[model samples]
Target chain A: MSAAARRGVLPGFGLSTGFTVLYLCLVVLVPLSAVALRSSSLGWQEAWKVVASPRALASYRLSFGASLLAAAANVVFGGLVAWVLARYRFPGRAFVDALVDLPFALPTAVSGIALTAVYGPTGFIGRHLEAAGVRVAFSPLGVTLALTFIGLPFVIRTLQPVLEDLDPEVEEAAAVLGASRWETFRHVLLPALVPAATTGFALAFARGLGEYGSIVFISGNMPMRTEIAPLLVMTRLEQFDYAGAAALATVLLLASFVLLLTINRLQAWTRTRAGAA
Target chain B: MSIVVREVEKAFDATPVLRGVSLEIPDGELVALLGPSGCGKTTLLRIIAGLESADAGEVRHDGEDVSARSARERNVGVVFQHYALFRHMTVEENVAFALRVRRRPRAQVAARVAELLRLVQLEGLKGRYPQQLSGGQRQRVALARALATEPRILLLDEPFGALDARVRQELRRWLRRLHDELHVTSVFVTHDQEEAFEVADRVVLMNAGRVEQVGTPAQVFEEPASAFVMRFLGAVNAFKGWVEGDRAFVSGLDLELVAPASAAHRARAHVFVRPHELDVHRAPVPGSFAANVDRVLPLGAAVRIELSAPGFGGMVEAELDVRRSEALALAPGDAVHLSPRRVRVFPSREDELDSLTASGL
Candidate 1:
């Protein structure tokens, strides 16, 4: 048989690939192209003026900086939560596991409202912190708090299954060989977990970078201080500055794609290492 | 060195898995805990290895109580039925794991691991992972790993039970040689009587969470302690009868009492004789008992002739050599005379009804 005949039955390959390419053109590539086309209608000098403005630059710093902060925080604490949920059989474990998926299921607007009620100065936890003189809402810190809240499930869900799939027999064997608990986790468990943890971190980061609805109510979107990129794009659109809005959106979109691509590369690399081992 | 287990008892929920099992194994002796499934043999082995806790017993190593010690602290090596070799590590790395975990010197570990590979006769295969090896090779690697720790006692749970028939026999012989070379106080658990008899110096037959008999292989196979052991070893012709004075009356059968005079006074008794012990001949031998061949089986060198006779309700098996078989012209319908040279008679285990599960009746 010829090579074409040999390749006749790759299951769902043609249909799924066709669907993926069309969906990307409609939802991702076409929209990105439209954003680029609209941004290009502005003269280069004018586009530079809109993008490099001190207000725009400050939004860049806060948005990217706060998202990084949130993603970093999630990588550590989210991992702890995932490990606990995966390894232990505590009372109300089901409830706690369900709570990890709350961010995925609940509307971002509802989460924003709930978080504002709880963390706003007049709200329950806010009052206690206010007495301690630590202001949270309407600050960049509050933007980070919102992003962390929405991004946590990405990290935990990605990691929990990987940790759970790892066999405890490996650990038992290690212990029987005279290795202590710390050494076993380091030598055996951690090597297997590295890939999953990295994937989780990348997911949380990408999600935080594009987050808008959840942070808007809590951030108090002040220009040059608390305004983030997504909020800035909305402000330009509301003012009918289409060129400026499109330019900013295009930049954010490109940054997010690059970050996600890099993460995907790392994930592929990790999977290869796991398979090789 | 020497391992002593005393009053070992364990219970899972309300069901007792082990009931007061006791044994003393001398240094360099390879003893086998031999029994059928759920006989508490594996449980006893785990208890000695410190992988499991005994509820009411003590396991001592060199006269020191190590019952409460953790598996890691006990410094005993164990080989599981599945080998349980780490899939991620090469043969050398797996064998070296115990020494590495104990934080031995790197140079010494390398040398010792090399020595162990040679000892288990897998020198060139050290670089391969467990999944890359066959079942027999994996078991050998497991044995090598267990020895790598320089453990005083090695516990193997059905180590060769997973292999094919030919491989199982080959490994048993190899294990006997390995035990002789290592001289560790090794305790292996197995249900296959053939494996136990072949590899172990002392065989402990367990039944229903208790040690039924403990002796050399020949002793246990030849002189069983109870009906369970006797039936488990091989087929034995038996009769239930009542004893009166110096004679025993076998119900529904006529035979002179051959049991001890002490057993002659017992109200009820069970008389047993092995199949191969009965002598069968074609012509009417003057002193031989009378019978007819009910069935015949040619089992390689010997022909097993199952006989039925008048006044005896059950069939009795007698093994004859090919020469004797030809002389007798043995067939299913032929008349024959069977003379049993040996018999064992014991008092009825009627009281065992109350503790049915424990007595293994």
Candidate 2:
């Protein structure tokens, strides 16, 4: 018998497996490997120097730090938004629900320009804020704000279904057992929501790290300040330094992949613990 | 603690769910709110538990009015139909939740959790999560969790409704024993009449958002207050007829029904008979109706005979012991006689009698 015939009851197992592996390699692995190979041609010492320069290091810190801050803010406010969308009914609820996906559906560059217009020094809400000695545009905070705007939908969308599926009976059960509303939330509801919320946080954070279009318009791109790693890679490419751009892109890709993998593992752990319970 | 619910009324979006529901549950009594789905039994239980508020009513615990209090303030415990164990917690943690939420000492929480685990016979599975346990075990965990704080009253909403028949039976017996041991003022809602009769001290029958009757198992089973209760108790046959001269003159049956003395003057009535109370005979007899056997079904210990009379539009059922049915050799098209050993007659309300006859009962 042929190996394919002996594989299982299902037919064409070998052919399907071969196709799947080939498709993944061509679509995902090959492009990623090309970046690594191109960066390798620069020689390790030069590549290291390029990625670890004072300017490059500052950009790295701003990119990762702003992404972290944006993800943290989204976890709080995005969770509230998701909870409201899932649990309550108010005027324009359907409209507001549709609006959550605006970040995902709007062109990133359009959102960037819109956010800049709204939060610019002379803009609608920003004029009052600037007079109050707060600046949201053309700074590191502006970059973070832009990232937050783009990342909002990731967290809300991820947590919405999980929140909706959470049984209200359990909360009522807790209340009837003498837990106050806060206690019921903290002890019963929060524990069930944590895994999904963490997954959302990770997703939002990953999206923020790679965000380029939205940040470029709002961020002033000042070296060692508002400049982010993706912008630094783009600058390198514009300067005709392919190896430097490839190295920077490879570093961002590896860092994000590692962090996202760790977060995914954390989410899986929580899910398993919840399943076991 | 004893509970008294006074004329509780509730509505959902203008559709009335509970209409002036009132009941008194004395301390240490286990009552079952029995009804079909959508009858508002579960809603009434929720009202008493303080999980839901009545539009107009007062709920009192031990003579203290708690209508304005929240569920947390009322100190009640509720077990949901699907167990509702916290999926993120271990069995021990779920049982300990009430105490822990109250900020009880760690040692005290541990001790109480251990005690409850033992009570629920789940000591060995304390560290396991709800998903790791079988349905029966999850329900036991839910029960233990509810009982953790020693709440004055415990409410369960169709506690075994999610389990299969075998597991449901096992859990029913376990719940009966647990109630005996705890003796908390408890009320559980269930649609299963057998479960209600077997497990509850008293059964409160409900229909169409109204309390039909409240009595002990025997009382409700033997002397249902209304035709609705009689039919809901299951395996019942209703005959639309008139009662006069101490006999019920049914439309289709040739035999005369022995009506209760009090029902003798009623011009119109609905007479009900349970299948088991009916006897099937090979030869026609006085006070018995002639019927043609439509089918014979062996139901484990007994045989159910489906019969149809010439003039009766609907079929009547009779159950006989397995061995006796075998000796009689009853079959389809065989001529037989049926005599009801027990019957209940209620004065026919115009709407109810119309519905009963329209349903071909």
Candidate 3:
């Protein structure tokens, strides 16, 4: 089979590919191409000067660092939540599951305000933490906290179905065959949940990277220290520096695309492994 | 090793699954827990394996009470009907799973797994995954895996129930031979009476969460303890009769037979006789009741003649070999004489026994 036809495992190959390209052009490619055109109009030397300034680098650091931290936190906590929901039966399970998706339904602006009120220096539980000299709101840490809050649901929701589909009999069979609970989970459960967890991680990371509304409210928008890539893009747009904004947007878009590709590869690899076995 | 289950009772919610179930499975003996579906046979096997906890009972293996022990600690092997083979592993890895989990020495694990694969006659297929193997091959792999740990007792829950007719029959003989060679105390749960009769050294027939009869295959077939057992064993031609003095008088037909023992106490009774045991001759034989053949079904090797005798309200199934059927020259609507050799007398209280037999529990 030809290379193009070989990737035709998905149904209605030509039609789906055409639709996917059209959708990408409408939603992503056209806007991204416009951004690149604007950036190029500044000429290579001028674009580099705007993108590599110390403040731009600092914003890059804060944005990438906070996103990584938030994504890492989601991986651990989301796995725990998925395990509990999948492996055990408890009262209010449906309600707990519904609560996990609350972030998806709630407006980001509303979530940002809620987080600030709950964790700000003079707010409810924040007063005690503030008394201890541990600040949460209007800081880099607050940005991370807000990102974590928005990114958590992606991981848990992605993994819950996979975890539920895992056969309990496999674990029992492992145990009877002499493996302890830890061994069973390590050998039988973890291998199956890994691909799902990786997909969740990538999704959360991508979401955290481009996050604007929630982090902007919590970070206090201090340039060089608190401002992120998305904020910088917004700043450039406000100052009518469309070329600089496009350059920054291009970087975020490329990183997100790479991460999504990796996630797709991981999902395919996992399915093949599961099917072969 | 011998397994002793004492007064075992299990209940799910408010319904009892197994009640007052007790049995002794001697070492190296293949005991079959045979009953129809919902008969609690599988529950009894699970209880012995410590997979299901008995509400009130003690499970002892080799003189040690294993009631408090988990399934792993009980050292029992179970092969489910679905095989439940680990699809993620190859045949060798699946067989070696038990050893690997116990953290046995690497050399020993490899050697033992190799040996087990050879025993199951899948040496060439060791590297193949379960999905790559046939249905029969997967089951053999499951059996090899179960036996990997050198279990004290092996439990099989309808292992061949999922196989095709030809494979099921072939596996039964192979399993009997394997049990003899291994000499391990094994208990298998099966709803198929023929399977139990063919494979088990002793068959334990269960009905309604209770042991209806426990005996050798011939014993159970010849002397079923209850009316339920007689019917469940095979198709029986039943004759409702009343006992007077030493004889049982047929209700509708002018027929009488001397009661054997304890038959006089029951005012009304039903006699059980196997279909093949009824002699059908072309001529009106002596001391035989005349019956009109309603239909004749030619099953490949055997012919079944449905007869409506005067005494029995419903038709009775009478089996005859093709040759015997040819000699009789029986056809639909033909008049013939059916003389049953021996019949079992069951009390009228056994009328509800049909429901019990049908439910198999």
* DockQ top scorer: 2
TM-score of each model, paired residue for residue: 0.80, 0.94, 0.91
Better of 2 and 3 by DockQ: 2
In model 2, the Cα lDDT at residue B212 comes to 86
Model 1, position B354: C-alpha lDDT score: 21
lDDT of 1 by residue, B161-261 (tens): 89999888889999999888889999999988888988999999888888888999999987777766776676788767765555555643434545353
What local lDDT score does residue B220 receive in model 1, on the 0 to 100 scale?
92
Please provide, for model 3 over B59-102, each residue's C-alpha lDDT reduced to its tens digit, 9 standing for 90 to 100. 89987999999887777888877877776677888898888888
Candidate 1's residue-wise lDDT over A64-101, tens digit each?
89888888898889989999999999999999999999
Proportion of native contacts present in model 1 = 0.25
In model 1, the runs with Cα more than 4 Å from the true position are A1-79, A82-87, A131-133, A154-168, A223-229, A232-277, B234-251, B254-361
Q: lDDT scores for all predictions? A: 0.83, 0.88, 0.84
Model 2, backbone clash pairs (residues 3+ apart or across chains), number: 3
What RMSD, rounded to one decimal, does every model reach?
A: 4.9, 2.8, 3.1
lDDT, candidate 3, at B263: 59
Interface quality of candidate 1 as DockQ: 0.30
State the lDDT at B328 in candidate 3.
79
Candidate 2 Cα misplacement greater than 4 A, ranges: A1-17, B252-266, B351-361
Interface RMSD per candidate: 2.4, 1.3, 1.8
Q: What is candidate 2's local distance difference test score?
A: 0.88
